[model samples]
Target: QGRGRRRRRVAPLAVSPPPASERGEEPLLRGIFEIGKRSCDVVLSARRLRWSPIVPESPAGGTGREEIIEMKDVFSVKLKRRRFVGQKKGGTLLGITIFKCLHKEENKLTDCAVHLNNLSEDHCNSWFRHLKEILNGFQNRPKSLKVFVNPSSHKREATHVYYEKVAPLFKLADIKTDIIRIFIDFVFCVGGDGSVSEVAHGLLLKAQIDAGKGTDYIPAPVRASVPLGVIPAGEAKQYCYILSVICFKSLWHIL
Candidate 1:
């Protein structure tokens, strides 16, 4: 050949939608906000996210067939980049470095050996920049948040672990709370399917009481029919498997 031409190969851009496992049975964007003592994770669907608080009982009265109850409609909001950054730091850092930075950046940075040792100076600086962005964004976000907890499901120590390990991250995310009382948008049980049933029952009772007074006691859009989230804390979390509850083990992968 007298003349030859070479072709350049172009790399394809890869764009991925949120995993079905995280998005659940429906395709919707979810926003997770930390509300002080509690964390609220909201999921929005195209129409509305419906939750049934009660299931009708069987005629025999031995067991009741669960009936779906409609909860509320919500507009999906994508999880902010900062929230994701906070999650990443929570997994890596020991405590709320960002908040500590707000008050005493120098002291906090010096004390956090675990985080410092693991992360390089460049990484740490980048994280702080990301945290600043997140803090700026939180100013315009909603103040209230929903909380879900499974008191009876996890081992006795699990709660302590959550307090020590997880709670600080929420603080870092700039989640605020009342002085004495904590207002949770929604509280959920973290156990087997039975635990979910128990939570649903409790929520239904609360809803009935609120309805009697003609006041919305639970303000979160998902009040009585709050969305359920779970982490495998018990010996056998069979329900978690069915519902596709995100587990701690899988968190690293998803986030």
Candidate 2:
């Protein structure tokens, strides 16, 4: 018999475990609930909500699939109910509804709701209060917003876009909003360069006036009291260089 060639031996690659925050954190609450049509075992941690389908006992004993949603993405939580038309006094408690922002393709975000169905009102109420407290603890997220949309921008599609896409998400998130004719200290504009410049200029002028400085012969303009956010809804070809620089800075800040 010919001698077999020596087989090369390779060690298995080591896979790192998830971080302590993700893997080792203790759950705040655990319960049994129906998600969609399947019964599931649900768990809530400080930073995540997890649900796993409850599998029946089997000789082969396998783990059911688990789904997780980050708490940061959750915006609102409410007690779900079922009521007949014109019967608003009290409705049957169905379960809990959680509204969250879900990441979609191409870096877009969509509002979504998850219903945890349970017959017991007390159980749902406990979960609802815990979720509400968790949501309220996110201080970085805004509770209310003042929105100003330029109706003439993007072939007059800006208003439609706001109402159809943006407003719905805000509403679902339970974020109080003022669709301003004009409002707020920290203003934002949803239009092209002209709209941005107009808003920025007005803020600067207001800053100068507040500081008792004359507009005609101002050596140094006062800094704007509040920040301005720009949402590009129109083309800015001529100002592309400046916008790109600003965008780069914004991205840097975000990162």
Q: TM per model?
A: 0.21, 0.60
lDDT of 2 by residue, 137-179 (tens): 8889898999998664444567898999889778777899998
Model 2 poorest 10 in a row by lDDT: 180-189
Per-model CA lDDT versus the true structure: 0.40, 0.79
- Please identify model 1 stretches exceeding 4 Å from their true place: 1-179, 213-225, 245-255
Candidate 2 segments exceeding 4 Å error: 1-24, 59-63, 87-89, 182-255
Query: Quick one: best lDDT, which candidate?
Result: 2
RMSD of 2: 16.6
Question: What local lDDT does model 2 show for residue 10?
Answer: 94
lDDT of 1 by residue, 1-255 (tens): 646867778889888887865453462433322223223333334323222212225354232222221111111111222335436533433221212212246454211111112123443444345434433444455554554544432323445655676566455444553322233444545666667557666666655554453344645423453344555556676767765634443453434
> Residue 153 in model 2: shift from native, Å?
2.0
Instruction: State the local distance difference test value for candidate 2.
Output: 0.79
